[model samples]
Each structure stands twice: as structure tokens, then as C-alpha cells.
Target: MKRIALTVSAILLLFATAEPKQKKAQPKKQEATSVQQEAMKVLMSGFSTDPRFTWKTQQDEAQRICSQYPSMEAMPAQAIQKVIQLSQADLRYPQWGIFWGDWREGKKIVENPRGGRFASYGFSDSPTDKGGNCYACHLIEKGMPGGTMGPNLYQYGKRWNITKENMNTQEALERVKAVYNIIYNSWSAFPCSSMPRFGHNGALSPEDVMNIVTYLLHPDSPVNK
Candidate 1:
């Protein structure tokens, strides 16, 4: 009876201390949330409510879910699957199909460092000024200076064993399709990836994405050489 009474006393003391600590933690969490909201409001105040800018500020369903976590590794399995499902559902392919486009055009898009950027000081992008700016994230060609944010793509086609001899095979076509899907919507392959959903966001047309895929995977392209 004496030991049982001591154990009960310990439990009661722990509850008394923990309850106050939890109550104190609640206000801190609310304060942090309020600060974050205020910071976002301040950031949004700089941009105009124009239709072009509106899309940049708005979060879609996938983006909303992604924002809840700091990184993909931290995301729960359910959230990761949700993001993948959303990305796959949102994919749009070229009307011509998933065949590779002109690799030359793809090279230009990959190398060009211009795209949909907005600035109030006469630096806004025109509707026709579209580019993939792929070099900013990946090393596409040999000896090219590119950011290390994404994987090195030099000799990507050779690395994949893609060649003219087997280009027409069903396996080759499936590989091409997989690359196309990643370029169009990276989240389908890697949920909450740092890579942008180029085609899904209309940043790149289906034709443009196919061209990039060709540049990365075509045997004759400099990327393979």
C-alpha cells in the first residue's frame, strides 16, 4: 500500500507539471503562426493583383499540401502519395504524342536563361519569351557551367544506354515516356521535388518539354556525345 501511494503521488505530480507546460506551449505556437501570417502579408503587398502575378501568389492543392512540410523527406507517406496522385492527374501531353521533338530546339531552350519572370521596372517577361532555363539547375552538356541543384546530365543518353540501334524498340519508347512525364510533372516521379512542374504550370508547352526530353535522351544530341 505504501509503494502504491508513492507511485500515485508521482503520477499526480507529473500531470500537474506537464499540464502547465502544455498550456504555456500553446500560446507560443499561436504566436509563431501569427508572425508567419504577418510576414506573408507583408511579402504579398509588394506584388500587384494582376492576373499574371495572381497565379504566382496562389497555392494549388498540391502546393498547399507540400507547404505543410519542410522537405520531401519530412512528408508523411499519405501526403507523398497525395502529391504524386495530384501530379499524375494534372499531366498534359503533346497532341502529337510523346515522341522526341527537335533536339536542336531543345538545346536552345535548355541553354537560354530567360523565362517567365516579372518585375515592375520594365523587366517583365513577354508572353512569347518562354524558355526552360534548364542549365540553371542541371549540367546538360560537357564542360558546361551549371548549378549543382539538380543532377548532372552530361552524357545522359549514353548513361541510359539509349542508341539509334534500339531507339524504335518498345522499351526505348517507355523510357522516353518516363522522361517526358518527369519533365512535364516532376512530382509524379518525386513528390514535392525541388524541380518545377514545367508543363503542368504552363511554364513549358508539351512541345517544349518533348524537345528537352529529346535533348537529354537522343543519341545524336551533344548530351550523348
Candidate 2:
């Protein structure tokens, strides 16, 4: 009993004399985040702006959220819905109830890729100078070769049953509106779409978009042939 008491006392004395352990400092995660943000700012500042190609340094809410996650699959359903809602809110419809335009003009825009690009920085921001480059990712024309990045849009109007006869019908108009929404901000229609937000990103104007709609939906368009 005495030995046990002495051993306990010795243990207590040793503990009392021992110094407290200090915790090692953690790596500063926020510091890395700040540095990453600053680096992006610096990179963005390197680009000079022109009339058509303005250097956008900041990300919008949808972009921010999308960037935070690698892909839409990495994001939750709520987050995906949030991006869609934000894109939908910013959608700008065509003015004066004019949804369709000259399909010939639309074909020109679709065939050309140099329009409105940074490469065309010095040129005027005219419709003739800007292009949708739709052929880069879609097979719009039947025999013409196109990129396979996007789906084939051959006979798009025919598939939708849109023709010159019923192009002015209420249902056709609704279809036009749907197409406009898809082209304006594809993410609005599909939250995880890889398609570019042509209107939202300022790559295409309202008039340009309407013309593209015509190219895809007009009965007289070569796309329908």
C-alpha cells in the first residue's frame, strides 16, 4: 500500500513538473484562397478591352458557383437549380414581338466563326462582322460537314413540324420562344449544358439570336431542306 502511494505521488510530481504540449500552427487555407483570387485578378487585368471584346474580370453569380465546382455533377441539385434560375432571370427576350428574322442572314452568321471574336477586336461590331459559328459544333446543313461537339440540327424545323404554312401559329410562336431561351442561355433550359450562353455572355445580340432562330426554324431555310 505504501509503495503504491509513493508511485502515485511520484507520477503526480512528474506530471506537475512536465511542460504543457504546444499545438503546431495549421497551414493558412484562407491565405491560399486570397492568393488565388489575386492571381486571377492580375491575369484578368492583363487583357485590354476593345469595343466588341470587353475584358470581363469578374465572374457573375452563376459563373462563381459553377467555377466553385468542377462540373454540374459535383454540384447539388439545389445549386444547379440556382444557376438555372439566375440565368433565366437575366434572359432578355427579343423586342417588338419579333422572334424570327432573315434566314439568309442567319446562315451567314452560322457559317462564319470569326464574327464577334477577340480576333475581330479592331473591326466594327456589325452583324456582318459577327458570327455564331454554329457549324463548329452542329450539323445544321444536310451535306455540309460540321463539328461533332454538339448534336445534329439537320431538318430541325421539319422535326418540330414548323413550316412556312404554320410558322405564324401560336404553337410555332411558343416554339420560337423556347428556341430563343435555349440559345440565349442554354443553362436556363438545361442547368449543366456545355453549350455557350451566347446572349448572356454577349457573344450574340438579340437580333443575331433571332436570326439564328430563323435559320433553325424557318421552313424556307436550307436547314429545313
Candidate 3:
């Protein structure tokens, strides 16, 4: 009887000791499984047509990185580096010798805001008559109001402060490149920037970009003057 009682007690003690370990392992396993399941859910979300009217080449890369983070997430540095290299490699400057055109024409391009066309793009000039749509994001001039989306461009040339040491012609050109890259490939500058890649998207010509740049950079231009 004593032997039987001892064996029973030993078995009960072994079960009692093992219970907490099993219980602790269960929640950890469940938490791990929950995390994995959540990741899978995000990765497997459905795709649809974006408002931009095209599934661009960089969209997949952007989505892949963006989906991993929580809402309002930024991309990793490695991914951003890849994006910058790709954007710069694909930076297509103005082929025509024309970089500056009439700023009056440029002004019209800024004011006219009626070029976004979906399936009904054929109702008007879809490709050629497209506006440069500057003021949509930028506050280009005091007379013209713009969305608060981008920074104010009023006296931007003077106020924006591009003061680098020894800002000679070469440095100026390099600064143009840096700024142009932002206007050309915003994703390169800021991975999650709301600014549109006007040149890259064929929304504006190089001449148009140049005129805008000239308006900002030229000492005589209103932006500087």
C-alpha cells in the first residue's frame, strides 16, 4: 500500500511540474502563430487598379516594402537605396536643346488644371495638351494659390536656402541635379513623398521643367528678383 501511494504521488508531482511548462509553451506558440498569420494576411491582400491609371514599374517594389510596416510606414534604407539607383539610372533629361521657354506659357501651364483623364481621356488631348500642373502641389506665386500639399514656392529661390560652400558653377549644376532628381524622381529623394514625378510620368516636358527651374533659379526671374 505504501509503495502504491508513493508511485501515485510521484506521478502526480511529475504532472504538476510539467503542466506549467506546457501551459507557458502554448501561449508562446499561439503568439508566434498569430504573428505569422498576420504577416501572411498582409502579404496576401488583394490587388486592384490604383487611381494613377497604371501599375508602374516601381509600384511593386514600393508596395512590397510598404506593406510590411504598420500604417503610415516608411521604407527601409536598403530599399530606398535601390529606388534611388533605379530612379537615377532612368533619369531622362530633356532631349531637345530647349530647357527654357516663355514663362508666360509656363504660367498658363500652371494655371490650367484640367488634364486628368481616365477612360474618357479621348474626349480631349490626353498626351499633348496635358498641363504641367505645377500649382496643384506648389505655391508658385503669391497671385496663384496652391494646395498645401507641397512647400510654398513664393520667393523660394531666395528663401529655400541652397547655401553650400563654394557654390560655383559646377556646384550649382550638381545642386540642380539634386533638386532635379527630386522633381524628376521624388521617390529617390523621399521614399514616401507625396510629390509626383512630373518628368518621369510624362506629365511635363523637360522644357517645361527647365522653364520652371529657370523661373526659380534665374536671377532676373520673379522668384529671385
Candidate 4:
């Protein structure tokens, strides 16, 4: 009986010790959350307070949801659906409709590496700097250096089977619209994608996005060559 009582006492002591350790972990988690909040405040204070930049510091509904997960794989199904719904709902198209724009003009926007980036140190973008800076993430044309963060798009138009003979067909128009939607709001198709929502955020206008779509889907563009 004495031995059984000692065993019970040891088990009770273990439970008591484990309970405090579990309780202690809760405070550490709270402290970590506090630290993260403080860090965000410090980072936001470094940017200029210009009205144009105010949007950068603020998280929209979709952004607030996305910020909770580190990556798409970590996101819950409900969260992913919510983000996609929000992204699709916010899409806007050019008043002229979703037709091919000037591919040559589109090429300039694709290759030019200046636009939308803001800094106070003499590097702030001028209103005229409307380049998409696409080469930063994609290889649009042959012989052009580009990053590997995104898939190689050296012959994007050719891969899509876009040809001048059929470029005006309903199927081709559908393809054009699909690509346009992706550029305008990538999260509509890919929740939590690394691709920026250029048109959705006004970084690029609808016309600009249409031109980019033309650059990628028009057979005559160098992206097909």
C-alpha cells in the first residue's frame, strides 16, 4: 500500500509540473504576437506619409486574411475561397472592352524596368513611368535576361497557339480575357499567389493590362518569336 501511494504521489507531481509548463507557453505566444505588432509599426514608420503611400501601409480585407498564412499551402480551404471571391469581385475591365491593344506599345511596357516603385530618395516614380517591369519575374522575349521566380514565358503566345490567322476567333478572345484576368488580379485564379494584383491596385491601368495581354498573346509580338 505504501509503494502504491508513493507512485501516485510521483504521478501527481508530474501532472502538476506539466500544467505550469503548458501555462507558461501561453504567455510566450502572446509575447511573440506583441513583438510582431511592434515590428510592423516600426516598419511602417519608415515610409513617407504621402497620401499615395497610405494604401501601402494599410491591409485590405484580402491582404489581412492572406497575412495570416505564410504560404498558399498553409492556407485553409475557407480562407482560400474567401480570397478568391474577394479578388474576383474587385476586378475591373477597360471601358473599351477586352480586345487586343497595340502589341508594340505592350512590348515597351513589358521590357521597361521603371514604374510603381516608390522611395523618397530621388527614386520615386514619375506619373509617366508606367512600365510593368515584367522582366523582373518573367522571360517574355528571346535573348532577354529575366528572373526565374516565375515560369519562363519566352514563347508564351506560341505556347498558347495564338496565331494571326485565328487571333480574332471566339476561342482566342476567351484566352485573351483569361490572361487579362490573371494580370488584373492573380489571386482570383491563384489565391495567395506571389504575383502582384497590378490593375486591381491601380499600379497598372486596365488599358495597360490589356496591352500586356496583347504582348503575351499576339502572335506578332516577340514573345512568340
Cand. 4 Cα-lDDT:
0.77
Report residue 90 deviation for candidate 1 (angstroms).
Answer: 0.9
Cα shift from native, residue 41, model 3 (Å): 17
Q: What C-alpha lDDT, on a 0 to 100 scale, does residue 117 get in candidate 2? A: 56
Q: Comparing 1 and 2 by lDDT, which wins? A: 1
lDDT of 3 by residue, 1-225 (tens): 787567545533543344334456778656655654554344334323454543442345554443343333455667667766666665766665333345555556556674222222345544346665667778777676787788787765565343334333565556555665676667667665667766666666666665656566544455554
The Cα local distance difference test for each model comes to 0.78, 0.74, 0.56, 0.77
lDDT of 4 by residue, 1-225 (tens): 786567544533443334334446888656655655665565566668887666776778898777666578888899999999999999899898988898887887777786444323245445456777888998778888998888888878877788889999999888888889998999999887888888777778788889889988888787888
Q: Give per-candidate clash totals.
A: 0, 2, 0, 0
TM-score of 4: 0.79
Q: RMSD in Å for candidate 4, one decimal?
A: 13.0
Model 1 lDDT, residue 200, Cα: 84
User: Model 3 Cα displacement at 151 (Å)?
Assistant: 1.3
* TM-score for each candidate, following the candidate numbering: 0.79, 0.77, 0.58, 0.79
TM-score of 1: 0.79
lDDT string, candidate 1, 117-207, tens digits: 3322245445346777788888888888888899999988877778999987888888998889998899999888878788887778788
Please report the TM-score between candidate 2 and the true structure.
Answer: 0.77
Better of 2 and 4 by TM-score: 4
